[model samples]
Target: MPATPASDDLREGSGARALLRLATPVVASRLGIMAMGLVDTVVVGRYSSAELGYHALAWAVTGVVLTTGLGLLSGVQVMTSQAIGEGREADTGAILRRGLVYAGWIALAAALFLAVTGGPMLHAFGLSAGLADGATPVLQVQAVSLIPIIVADAGLFWLEAHGRAVPGMLAMWAANVVNLIVNLWLVPGGNFLGVDGAVASGWATFASRLFLLVLLAWIILSWRRARELGVLTPAPRAPHAAQAMRRVGYGAAASYFIESLAFSAMAIFAGWISITAVAVWAVVINVAAVVFMVPLGLSVATSVLVGRAYGARDQVGMLQSAGQGFAFTTAVLLAVSVGVWLFPEGIAAAYSRDAVVIAGIASAMILSSLFFVADGLQVVAAQSLRARSDIVAPTATHLFSYVVVMMPLAWWLGVRQGGGVDGLIWAIVIASTLSAVLLWGRFAWLARRPLVPLAQPRAA
Candidate 1:
């Protein structure tokens, strides 16, 4: 196979253009992810605030597992880009295959873990018996959907690494259409299965995810370059390839797990306040997450660019890519923050009909906007670090910022001090700012060090 050219032209000015071109579709694709959650939140919140609380608690547990699995699969994107940078495009297919298998095992393990322990875990949080009980079955139903979505992500990441974000983006929005249809049909007592409310929403999630997996598979398998890219063939045996992939993933998985676990803990703190508090925090976090998709997309794009540069031993290209990514992320998030701050009440009103819940969400939403730029910068910086294989620093930084700093502060301010939902948002603001500073500093330090190429894969 001919060696595919890495982006040799990725220098000072061209890097920004490349970043924008890749980030546009990638951001839209990430939005499709949060858009599904937004739909579920809106549909269930309007149906019943109590049900929304059930949904939020259930998701708090599921979200942690989901993110950790996605983190473990992050190597698919990193390794694929690295291989292409090394001019070995054929190797990406093996990476995808390995990623799919790994994704399957992680999903199954997580689903079973949730099925067996989800109820007890919720109960252990000291939530009211009714809240715990209502969330248990919903969590289990959500567990069933995990298998499809995690596996689907492997394919999506592979496509994104090849600069083919459009297919995945289109497939995701198509899945959203499926999710919306099911949500509308089932969430408002329209289903004959006797399930309604949050549980029905859970089933909708399962259906849509299954549809997404099937659709994405068809797209990948049908691509004209599929065979040429080695998609149809077994990956040549390279003893170190799988190990390299997992090595990259381990740090990312740890970082994602720690951060997600801490954020989910915020929901637990809100639960301790009131069911109404949980419902409000749900709306605030969902909106923030929706906005966050932009930066997460930027992070993925930047990581690909940096990983390629790193693989090619091009320090200048790596720095340029990282710089462009940071500037773009900051500018985009600042604009989004202003928009979110300007219309918090209007945004909150769309999620729920209850005056009390809307009021709570609106205030918290305003507070949450303060963290948007910091949060965006932090993720972009972290991903850039990982692209260059400086993985442990980002993981350690997240652990300190989120678990050590944000978690206790959230409890202290939100629960101990009676500041409620607004307090939780404040905690996030502080932690995110600190994380951004630390991660960017680490990236700056690493970029100054001598460059080294990763070990090449052994021949089959």
Candidate 2:
């Protein structure tokens, strides 16, 4: 009925301690999201390396839309957190309602665009006919699943902005269980569903995502404060609220698109090299993504804290939260880097048993380990900038590092130099380090200036 003293103390604690408390469950939730794909990759890779190749190719295409869609709706989280700090907590429900409408349209548009053009895009890549043909169905299925997952993300973002990360963590892991069980049943090729291998993995994804959306909806409906929090009913429209959401969404979406394009293009480049290269890239990227969830979770925590501080005009708190996030991310990733370096083969073997694939993935993982800290740093920095409503610089950094630098380098090293998968990993390493340096430099420059108060929500 009443808030505990300890809870208030935690809310008012030093940035480092408060962030640690927030980030722990946030990281778990991010990892739970990644684990669903991890299970799909492992199951399909085990069933057939060829099928795994199909799965990777399909995901490469779907990932661009999925990630960009999430980015487009990130305004939901950013605005909600700022609302709390601005003493406009009542605005959060309106943010969620708007986010759902925005997310639904984006998801539908992406699904349609992908369904119509995905196969042709794969064919246009000049990949082997077999690879392109096989991936088309998988891509279509993955595309369909995006509708539910992206809409569900609005609810997840709303909950996390309110310091309710634990529920999302629980719901995501529960969905993971569903994904794993279904994958186990359908991926080995003899199911009544008439789906097998990578295709079965796609169906499992659709099922799990649907479950996730339903679970989140239930949570929101049953939340005791749902009405009081303005989550169940719409708040009176603030004049600039819609514009504010779009402002954040567009910048975030651009940054996300540029970066996702870089990685997805690399996957295509790997396919251009060889089927084996595609498989190895899948393994390496999968490992990197699993590790990436750590920083991503930290990014979410840092953004929320930074937004609140910005809203309250607490520049010192904003800086402290961001700094602690960077420090914590580097420390965790450094340990991860060491572990991955020491046991690349052990790690790669979990996805595929093929000796050649394992060797190739091991070598790439070694190089990837070297860049983990840089990768983690850049994300936290970028997210912190967004929370402060300084979104343009991060988009520029991505454009410079990923589009202007990473893409060409990947092609030149991996293709022109004939270095195969190792070459692509090296390209990512160089770009990620550059992005980290540039983004942190930008943050430092921004920190020295006077803090900009959070913008008022515009009239709807």
Local accuracy of candidate 2 as per-residue lDDT tens digits, 106-174: 989999999999999999999989999999999999999999999999899988888888888899999
Task: Mark the regions of model 2 whose C-alpha exceeds 4 Å error after superposition.
Answer: 1-10, 452-460
Residue 50 lDDT, candidate 2, scale 0-100: 96
Candidate 1 lDDT by residue in tens digits, 1-460: 3433323323224778888877899999999999999999999998999999999999999999999999999988998988877777776788888888889999999999999999999999999999999999999999999999999999999998888888899999999999999999999995787899999999999999999999999999998778877788887766678888888899899999999999999999999999889999899889988998999999999999998888788999999999999999999999999998999999989999999998998888888889999999999999999998888999999999999999999999999999999889999999999999999999998877989655664321
* Alpha-carbon TM-score of each model against the true structure: 0.97, 0.97
Clashing pairs in 1: none
Least lDDT summed over 10 consecutive residues: which range in candidate 1? 3-12
User: Model 1: what TM-score?
Assistant: 0.97
How many angstroms is residue 190 displaced in model 1 relative to the true structure, after the best TM-score fit?
3.7
How does model 1 fare in lDDT?
0.90
